[model samples]
Target chain A: MAPQDDNVDAVEEAMVAEVEKKPIATIVIIIAMQTEALPLVNKFQLIEDHDSVFPKGVPWVRYHGTYKDLFINIIWPGKDAVLGVDSVGTVSASLVTYASIQALQPDLIINAGTAGGFKAKGANIGDVVMVSDVAFHDRRIPIPVFDQYGIGARRTFSTPKLVKELDLKVGKLSTGDSLDMSPQDEAAINANDATVKDMEGAAVAYVADLLSVPAIFIKAVTDIVDGDKPTAEEFLQNLVAVTAALDQAVTKAVDFISGKCLSEL
Target chain B: MAPQDDNVDAVEEAMVAEVEKKPIATIVIIIAMQTEALPLVNKFQLIEDHDSVFPKGVPWVRYHGTYKDLFINIIWPGKDAVLGVDSVGTVSASLVTYASIQALQPDLIINAGTAGGFKAKGANIGDVVMVSDVAFHDRRIPIPVFDQYGIGARRTFSTPKLVKELDLKVGKLSTGDSLDMSPQDEAAINANDATVKDMEGAAVAYVADLLSVPAIFIKAVTDIVDGDKPTAEEFLQNLVAVTAALDQAVTKAVDFISGKCLSEL
Candidate 1:
């Protein structure tokens, strides 16, 4: 048996309480960066890279946690939309990752990533924001304006209520088929009224809803959509603070869902 | 050049100006039937069974006009809703096909097909009906009751000037996603006040409008969605009358769109 597989099942088996008791997760934290810190976060078990299903060299790997009943799965979809990735390819990757997670049957879904702040006001780099809705744009069916083929105008599933209760400030987000940050495109999008841009949320939302799992997506505002103000380096300087804090939040979320770590894993 | 490739370019060339100068197609028929006759209605063309894009045997093939742009193009979907096939699949397929047609730049679009009469007034088989507006009864997306997905909804389109001149009787239409029907489903649909049920016209309209194309879709009443009434024999009885009349109308459309056949090579 795979050591990681055994660890997850053990936690799930040990945490059975009531009929509705979803498996108590040991603890799993998702990060946007690659660092030797994987062990530092999940207790130095064994973290190994695995083959990703998407052709784009995106990374996905399973981590064996130091605790007897916990393991973490990590996936990295390298940088924003302009890396020449199509929306279909992005959705396909997200679906495979979500399905892989479902096969493991985790109690909750957490997607950790960075987003471009299209905010006209207050939102700045390093603010942790919870996504309430995800709109997949650029899926042009070459037809009318109707959302018949899963356009942004079509709402998939509302963010789950339990997660919504966390009272995160809501924002409308859009995804382009590829990374294009020209002024004209940004102006047109601002005209459409979305405040953030990201690639993976809609795919995560689409498949997770189909599989009956609740997904909680958190993003660290990484880039401003061609704003007039700050220099790029000045903006990224705050990322370390955001990643460290976001990691703590992910840990709390994992522990709350998986009771085995009620005291310590 | 491959003969089929040569044929395609010839058809494309013919459609250029000669195709545009034909009299405005008086009526566009939208037909989606699971089992039906060949594409050309009254032309005494012998049909040699050929493999179609569909794996499960195409029941119909164009006797030269449709695929060659004799009338516009012929689309054969393997399924239909109401008394025929799956509603959602056909609806989705119709949307995609029509979108591609628009991409090809059509001057007109008509949905010609079989539909179940779900009106309480009780329609028998083979009656010709023109739908003014169509609404989709069962599409739900987190919206309040004040909002709907507009399946068979009334007056959904602007109903172009030429269409009004033809002066066909107006009827309401609603579509279900499956061929399976129940007396109660019939009753529910009847109560919603739609006069007929079919798979793809309104859906076609939804996308056609997005592409800014003029469209006219007409259907032949094939099944009564209400309580048990017409027999299958009675339905097939008018097949000749319906097909012949439809053939005439389609010819006029071809003539209008083709501006009289151009000199052939």
Candidate 2:
């Protein structure tokens, strides 16, 4: 064989070795809303599990299936049985995340949801941001050290290679239970240096960190929190499009994460 | 036997039967702060658990011991390791409550803590409130049905017997992450018709309801949210005294719960 043929064979062997080494087998994607979860579920061909996958009588829903080399599960805090509204706050998110971790024991956690972005931070509707850090914008316990504790700032697992490979925009995320921002929340969000805000990212980060599992936040902007448009109307108008954008981003991220080591991401 | 002797024997037999009926064997008391927990821990003579009762490296502390006929466990979301501050929000409260339920499978859960009361609601300093209803004051999602969903209101386990026996003050409680109330939170609180506001009661109620565990709220007044004094200064000044009040109330509640069934409470 020619020297060129030998070089080509060596490159092919390295690529095969990388593909064969499966470091991350199982992944749990925790989405707070059914609208945010359905597209991914369809894309992955996940089956809805109703028979005690989660504790019965609870609104938490789980869908599971295999995608490439990854065993993927999507966990959504289902609609409140009485009120018939999506349970979309940090309380539901944290419990669902903790329960998912306990049940699935996933190698990694992905918190995917729609968020409100800041116009000043150059965020537009339909932009998908890979969050680098997360902090609470409304947990204002103003006592000396406890004030810091209330913020509960946490860093998501670093994904430098994934960010570079996918060419994704990166931002810090702030979380609070309120869908609309208050003055105090704005100040706290500013202090966090956040470009996007949501109700569940920081909470999921807290639980994932507590369990020693690596977590990444993927948020698509549904509204501009500081812009001229009313937040409720804006969010409602753009949710479908933003969710579609989020679905695409998550799909690409999962493809990149499949069969890769934590260090590689 | 004489007729008087026969009547005395019948009364004694009834007393023995009541004592033997141990309906509620295990009870879990979830307190948010160390200050709130230490007093109850001493009162119940609970031994601190440092082993795998909770997961390793997590700051949640469990104290377990038997008090009368009830196996009592007090779970405190311990101080944050980095910030050295008590974890006092709904996130921590919900997680610790869920974990305790999963580990101990308690027959009843008591969320004992300090809260801000309303003077207009006939609340005074050191008053311990047995919350009848719980709702969120800060989860302000402004959409139509979601606006109500954001409140996440739920009635706590009915404690008519406990209330009648202990003569505890009953109030509707509202929860938020912030120690200080914002205007939005105030409006939500008013809508819920809340008389007391805390950081964790409604969250615990949500978890307890989800798990089908009976839960009661016992909160001592630490500060008045609508009072003239600043919230942070007031909370710091009264935390110790209020915690003592909480300890007494929880002790009495536990005593009442010891040998009783859920229907009795």
Candidate 3:
């Protein structure tokens, strides 16, 4: 065989060896709202994972499918975090995340959703962000003790090579319960130097950390929090566009993981 | 009749009129842990509110009873905000609080539970606190928009007279999703000037605010977040004592509200 053909055969052999040695298994994609989850679900053609039972009666649904030879489970915890009808915030997000972790035993977790970006940080609406670290911007434990508690900053694992390939913005993401913000909150966020804000990232990340499960957060910005338009309006108006971006990001993330596994061979 | 006797009769007549006019109807008490809630439930001899149903299968239970002529509902959402347990963080707390509001139609919501206090704020273990304002020390939304969102600082309705009567420490209570804290968290808490920290207060207060229902948070200090003892150890060691303090505070709060009804009359 020619030299180039021999190299190609060797690469193929290595790929098969890597798959046999360490194949990527289950991955759980946790999204707080159905709208935030739909794009990825449709892109992957995932079906509801009815066999994966949660502790019966928890208000959540899980979908699953094989993507790039890896099992992906998509979990929608509840409705939007917005006030009024069907609002699910941190509590539901955490519980559902914990439940999904237990039920699926995923090798990795990707919390894919939409967030409000900080324009000051060069993040614009529709920009996709990969959370490097998550902190509770709203969690105010008293000073001194807060540091001692060791929960001030929760960092997430990143596939550096994969991140480079995907060219995703890697930054801090802040999580809180409210969609509405105040000047004081803005100051806090700025102080933290977070690029994005969402309701469920911290909670979801916290659970994943506790379980020692590798997790990554991929968020598409639907609003510039400081933009002239109201946040609610911006969120609604850009939901479609942002979610589509999120869908693409999630796809890239899955491919990144799959490629990483093969490249390791 | 003598003048003294006539005055006494008039006073009695006014009391009767007050009862007829502004009777204490519904009071909801939202507690995080079952252990924290049991004291109040036992103290008041509360029975399960069979009529108050949540979305069938949500892991929560509500109890009700007539306390000092006011119908009281006690809701136990879940345990700590940690992983690998029956935990309900902000989401469950808010949802349960909202459900309780809808089902019980409470005129007042008292989020009664245990919290870690700031000793620098002169808070001692077993000291009962009445929340004047609730904010998310963990919820850091970025500036300009944060101010517009109106979620940075959520104030609770404080009846000065009632507070004075109950002799409770009225201060800011911070809410977050984690039980752990770190030095950095301490700085944030100090920045917010919060004296107490818990997982559920802000969520409950937020829902109550949205519904225009007056709410108060009554918390007993279980641990000084900065104390020498670990928070979990302190919490477990002081559980009974702190819960008792919470029980007493709740009773006083009930009496305070009931008295205000009578006083207005």
Q: What's the CA RMSD of model 2 in angstroms?
A: 10.7
- Write candidate 2's Cα lDDT for B1-265 as tens digits: 1124878779977864564354989989998988889888888899998575777657898999989998999998988867778888999999998888889988889999899999989888899999999999888888988988888889998989999998899999999998998888888888889889999999999988888787999999989888899989988899998888788888888888877877778
Report the poorest 10 consecutive residues by lDDT, candidate 2 chain B: B13-22
For model 2, the docking class works out as acceptable
lDDT of each residue in B46-160, candidate 3, tens digit only: 9986654664335567888887778888888743233213334576677677667766777778888889898888899899988888876654433334322323466787567
Runs of candidate 2 with Cα error greater than 4 angstroms are A1-22, B1-22
What's the lDDT for residue B180 in model 2?
A: 90
Q: Output the lDDT of residue B194, model 3.
A: 87
The TM-score of candidate 1 is: 0.39
Could you report the Cα RMSD, in angstroms, for every candidate shown?
17.6, 10.7, 14.5
Instruction: Report fnat, model 2.
Output: 0.79
**Cα lDDT of model 2 by residue, A69-177, tens digit:** 9999999999987778888999999999998988988888999999999989989999989999999999988788888888988889999999998788899999998
lDDT score, candidate 3, position A28: 89
DockQ of 1: 0.02
- Expressed as tens digits, the lDDT of each residue in A22-128 for candidate 3 is 65688888887777787788888999766647643244678888888789888886432242123345656776776677668777788888998988888999999
TM-score of chain B of 3: 0.84
* DockQ score of each predicted structure, in the order shown: 0.02, 0.35, 0.07
lDDT of 1 by residue, B1-265 (tens): 1124888778867765574455442223334542333544334242332543221212222221342333344544423211233222333334334434533455566666666665465554555556667755433211222124322244643344434444444577665443334343354466557777754555666445544455555656655656465524334555566665555544443444444322210
